[model samples]
Target: MDAKVMNQILEIAFEKRVSDVHFEVDNPPFFRGRGQLIRSKLPKLKPEDTEFIAKTILEANKRQLDPSLREQDASYSLPNGGRFRVSIFRQKGVIGIVMRVIPPHIGSFEELNLPVVLSEIVKAPNGLILVTGPTGNGKSTTLASMLRYLNENYSYNIITIEDPIEFLFTSSKSCIIQREVGIDTEGFGAALKAALRMDPDVIMVGEMRDPETIDACIKAAETGHLVFSTLHTQSASSTINRLIGNFPPEVQEVMRQRLADMLVAIVSLRLVKDKSGENIIPVVEVMRSTTTIQACIRDGRLDEIEKHIENGVAQYGMQTLDQHLIQLCQQKIIAVDEAKRITRSMDLERKLMFTS
Candidate 1:
């Protein structure tokens, strides 16, 4: 491995506050900062140089490291509080490495500019609260923030299971036990099943990777352990479907009822650059379970679920993505033009602007 080049690249990555660094053949190395991409200081990496850089990352994982050259996915901690989830692979005979910089410190709700209601969610002693979004949409940051909130305010045992374990947290009011996939445990399903026996008061599953893990999370919540998880779905209803759809058709109904019963809330978010083109703002859609909503979830009326979320804002803590986007625009935290683009309901964005 070209140790010098790799060291220089890490230096530049940390200096820029970049959240990720991507290297591939024939392209200039670039990194992500504050949700935006910035060019890397290192010149375009040659095929040979990229291979060396990729190998440097794999060597850090002794057990997972392969001398015969195989794709690997793991997290690494850099000097000065930088952490990354590195995935090394070969694409079209060219070495490629994608490293996502873990935020050095987890932020709180106020620090992340999330809704105050989130604090209420974290305060729950038991139930399932999901914060979900498409990849790179700041779901981890939000989840970290909520977990940090609990870390600071409550005196309880909080456990988290992450694939690569991004965003490290320090003990505060809560004692945290973080287990990473492949490192601390076998996999998501096994870790979740084990967490039940760990006697945890709160459990955070990094992402619901499969049916078994989802089932265990629901069971954990049902058994009086507050649960938090993520799914790669855009909205609340879609998140519900993603969970139920993971199971086979024969038992889907049973799982749906289980999900409906233990589910407490869901936060779906997207991060958009602000008006100044400086930083990103989080646009979220929230669904807090109510009698009517829980009833719809049980009866298979998922299609009509939006009405309750969009129309019952005052009655429940629910807020549509469009609602949050409009508010961001109104506050001038994000540009109206960009906000309109990412918003799910462009029609609603237009309508709300006029009424507000």
Candidate 2:
């Protein structure tokens, strides 16, 4: 398809509020909505169609797809102001694209159906707050909601370092300075280092993608800035291990200590279809770093972390994934089978039975 046709397809996707759109050679466009990938009945795309589509996206960002380049990350804004996070890649030796729709406006915690505990979690004056999940599971949306909350209620300086930034925010009660990784700065590490000197009360790094970025995030938190970032992990315990595991074995202990000191909370999310089978809802596992939990991390007792998360539910707004999945099942928000499918624990059925 040509640029006009591609834009028309995007306009249709935007109107329908699809989560993502896929364009690939030899296949009709596919749209993902409510956790389902539905193929459009339009004609299948040819190689030139996808190449032209990719070229349109790259040119919009003032970029060109080099012959040797295999993939790219970019953002696009529609004529109506809708935005998308675009991932352009090569598949089967032909250009393929996936565009994730970014809602024109950021939703509030309540509006997004996030747990009320997030309001309490974001109150921490300084420390690292991580929102972890597999890709496409609302981590960015959750972070954006938290920042929107801070922007409306608190008068502070907030700096965001992003790769092709999504969800534009206007200055409200807070002064927000958003720096894109390639356009406004060299990278996350450099931007984060500069952020510390910019007098920011809160800093949001789009993703902790590397050792330097991760280290910078922790240092920012340790120095009393509220930092937010994401990881492609499923749980709090795993998130900790992933961070520490990134370092050499000799220095893992030091990394663990740093994380224990600066980590404020871990909000893990999984989206599942609601009971109605038409909409998707998030099952959240929130682990606030209490003294006991901090000790678990510092002492390398990763196995005990989930138990403490389960125990801290009532007092500290903490909950394990299974616990929240059980709650969702109990409340009839999601089917029992869906809960069972999402939780990795062997005893999920047993726990649901006993808890119910």
Candidate 3:
């Protein structure tokens, strides 16, 4: 409960320009800087000290960090305007905490260097839009930017279900309602089930972690709510397959139908090292659900969906990861070798590198 300790942690997070801060017993705290991670020079924390810090995070948020206290998590803001989604848990019987720094204000598409399609995604009237990527790939940031765009441009009520709410939104052109997983509702599934009853025009789910959550999200979309969520997948097709695969075999057919009906677009993305080596830029593969894509999902020809993504241009706003990477390379936003290193298509990467 020491203000000085909390201030020091915030200072450390800001000084490193880190998106996250990690603290674990017996190990010195470390922060994830721009593109790399570095250990904090502060002395290693004791168990009691770690607990105190984690508890402080909980107290600051005024949310039950965790029900059982075996592991704890909370979202809180520093006095200086930075926010954090902090997770505290026991690993190897020692307390460990990770504080993901949330910027004071949301970054615009231009500032984040995201694609123009993102602006279009925010303006969608109905259906679901998914942002797909790995951890630390700025998926949350991308989602937040879209939500902020909607806020600034439209008058819609937005409800969010997040485990530890990341970016904070103040009403712009819309009224926003954010619900934390444990604090606001029992869980994502329960919160999503309740969200529909609230009559929201837009629903933002933090992550689709389970079938129940996905089911509720789909239902929300079906009933005409614009749904936005994230998934940990490598490609737009993978994101679709993962969604259908989340359901049981017996019900997958039904779920696929529901998904096809409500699906709008999937933006599978990753952060590749920039040419300047000072930052990372986002590369995305977009898949807009068309009639053929829907038929592919229904007929179990998910593989063919990739070809549609590779070729579809005027029909829908879509592109393949390899192509997106190539554009980034041509634009001098990212290096060819770096794109090749992170690219999933080895053959395509080779061709890209040679041509460029």
**Candidate with the larger lDDT of 1 and 2:** 2
Off by over 4 Å in 2: none
Please, what are the lDDT tens digits per residue for candidate 3 over residues 1-356? 26687677777687667788888888787888767788878788888777778777777767544535677667877777777887788877767888888877789989988777778766778899999999988899999988889999999999998988988889988999999987788899888888888989999999999888888889888899999999999887788889888878999888888888888888887887788888877888888888999888778788898899877865566788888888888887887788888887769667676757
Q: Which stretches of candidate 3 lie over 4 Å from their true place?
A: 63-68, 353-356
Q: Which candidate is the best by lDDT?
A: 2
Using TM-score as the yardstick, the better of models 1 and 2 is: 2
> Could you tell me which residue pairs clash in candidate 1?
none
RMSD of 2: 1.1
Per-candidate TM-scores read 0.94, 0.98, 0.94
Candidate 1 per-residue lDDT, tens place, 197-219, comes to 88799999999888788888999
State the displacement of the C-alpha of residue 69, model 2, in Å, after optimal TM-score superposition.
Answer: 1.1
Worst 10 residues of 1 by lDDT: 61-70
What candidate 1 gets wrong by more than 4 Å, as runs, is: 34-36, 67-71
Model 2 TM-score?
A: 0.98
Q: Give per-residue CA lDDT, model 2, range 199-243, as digits (tens).
A: 999999999998889999999999999999999999999999999
* RMSD (CA, angstroms), candidate 3: 2.0
